[model samples]
Target: MFPLFAARWDRSDLTASLTLFTGLMALAFCLVHLFVGQLRFLDRNPRSRWLSFSGGVAVAYVFLHMLPELGANAGAFHRATGLDEVMAESAVYLLALFGVAAFYGTERALKRSRGQDKDQIEQARPESSVFWLHIAVSSLLMFVIGYLLNHREDTSLIGLALYFFAMILHFVTADFGTRGDHPELYDDRGRWILSAATLAGWLLGTQLSVPEIAIGGLFAFVSGAIVLVVLKEELPEERKSFFLPFAGGTLLYAALVLSEQALSA
Candidate 1:
């Protein structure tokens, strides 16, 4: 699909044009959840299946694209920062590790504060402090995603397209899970606010001129954030999931990513 449009990828104007599309898509992703009840077929029995499938694609993307990119970026980060060779090579992984730990720690703290298993929390539970915490972190992550979509000029158009597709589904799954937990609280205003944050981030990224090292760090952080989010949503023991859909999503996106890498290589 990307190949068919390869020749049309005009570098000078492509990012500018696509930024608008990405922003609109991000906004739409958040808005879609308001109609969740009407979209039962996509959210029905074995509710975690959709999340699992999207999570699988997201995980595959992090492993196949982000990790390698970060590995390469770490060498540059080391050189730029004048660090010891070994330390420089480890920069990306260290940042990613902290990202993972931060997310895990946040979840643990939120759960402990509530004194109840989040996985078992019913819709009737008041939007606890944990709810606002989730909103804040999710907003931050969404903003980073919006920023990345516009700022990653190193990625070819096709690469961004694939990432966009996976992330859109990822957002869908995540938002659905969020709405489930805060049925009455995650209202239209709240949804619009989340969506606005994304657009604001995208607009800001377009105007900013950050360095390569900073961008690399952003990718590492987002990779960790994405991993925790998808896994947490899809892997709880109480949730029913379809393995075939999960595996199929994983393999399908993996194949696409591999093909893209092969062509570039």
Candidate 2:
């Protein structure tokens, strides 16, 4: 449902409502998967299933929640000021999708490069430098996208940047720590970078005044860090197994949803 132009942007109540709706939808999606585990049918492999379910929820949010709101708001905005919402909204979605695709693509590439056959690698490798590279590329893409949006004068660009950077850095840090071949010296460096990234995210989010997105980003960062820490201790033998990657995928999905919220906000 779209709102009508009233000759000026009123921050359409409908847009605001949609933002809240999408946020709730994202939270619900995560909680339901965490608790009910109904989507296990989507994939036979447990880890793959988790990644798919999480990714599915994120994709749904984009199509069902974010895109709809953009269409509605864009319609109203265009009617009132002769601006094109379709192109703007499309750009946002394209950038978001590109980030996700890049992460997955890079991950797949890494798995292949590691002498892993497609099926075996999916179950075997958990944490790898290639995987972390995927995260870094995806994160960097978010920053680029944010810069583009800001250059275009998108009001929510700053919030979007904060949200994307937080999650991206979280993944990057986790990946860095989990790399099986990482030099011991790099561990401390990785941790320091992660700490700085988290602090920077917090400060940026605060300065930008997007509390909701900030909280979401922090949640992702904390969750990722906890996963990496636990994995470092528990899976010493199979440090490169599917466990960590699965968790990373979940975090990436969270980041996507948060980015959507920030952009829409």
Candidate 3:
């Protein structure tokens, strides 16, 4: 028999291991933002199948895992916030709606600032103030994701692994999308700031603990934002995205996630 495997687990050892693992995952996220633009294969004009596949994986994660978890956490939100029954039931979802609307509005603002004409919009960079505003919003989102890595609803090893994988693919798509919008600004300044924001969030998570309701709210908002980002990237006409890889990635990750839930159940 394996004595160590049968031995009782120590709480301190488990905590230390989790901390080390999540910290490494956080670093991986930072690296992805910093270098994703350099992935020339994904920079194809016709849109790479890999890019579509990554979007599929991200979308699958949001719809399959995060949204359902938000519903399950509704009671926690009610108890923590002391809201009315109706408000408690709808609060998380309302927050999700707000997230989607906010990002959509920001995109519209950036486009309008570029110019009214399509050709002018394509060639002109967003105004300096607009570009910085976009970066600010994106950095805030990156911070939320990094903080959640340490304080996820499911802190089990497998849960963290699933979250990390989904978010990495999501980041690839997000970074690429931003680069398409502001190639020079994103490369010179935006990526570095976003990368730093993620690390800063991880650093804060190590130092602070918040109410579970607040964490759940952040998670829900992120889920909504992710849906918008994925759809916007994959649905555009010019991207010429492939459908087969997208569907394949979706089915593959969905099966894995559902199987994990069943085993844990």
lDDT of 2 by residue, 1-265 (tens): 1122112122222244324433342333223212232333422322343333333333333343334443444443445445477764454344445444544566456557656565465345535566456445533433332222211122343333333433333333333333332334234343334334433433343234333222223223332233333333224443323544445655665565555554454
**Rank order by lDDT, top first?**
3, 1, 2
Score candidate 3 by TM-score against the native: 0.91
Q: Report the lDDT tens digits of candidate 1 across residue range 1-265.
A: 4464342344345465576666776666656645653556666665656667887787777788777877887776886899877887687878888778777876665556645755555424543667777777778777887787765644565676787778877877777777666666676445665777777777787677477788788878888877887787778766676778788889989998877766655
- lDDT, candidate 3, 21-134, per-residue tens: 889998999888889887989977788999999988988998888888888778888898898767876998988887788778777888898889875776677887887888
lDDT per prediction?
0.71, 0.38, 0.82
Error of 2 at 164 (Å): 14
At residue 203, give the lDDT of candidate 1: 77
Count of clashing residue pairs in every prediction: 0, 3, 0
Candidate 2 stretches with Cα past 4 Å from truth are 1-60, 72-85, 123-129, 138-198, 208-265
Which pairs of residues have clashing backbones in candidate 3?
A: none
Give TM per candidate. Answer: 0.85, 0.37, 0.91
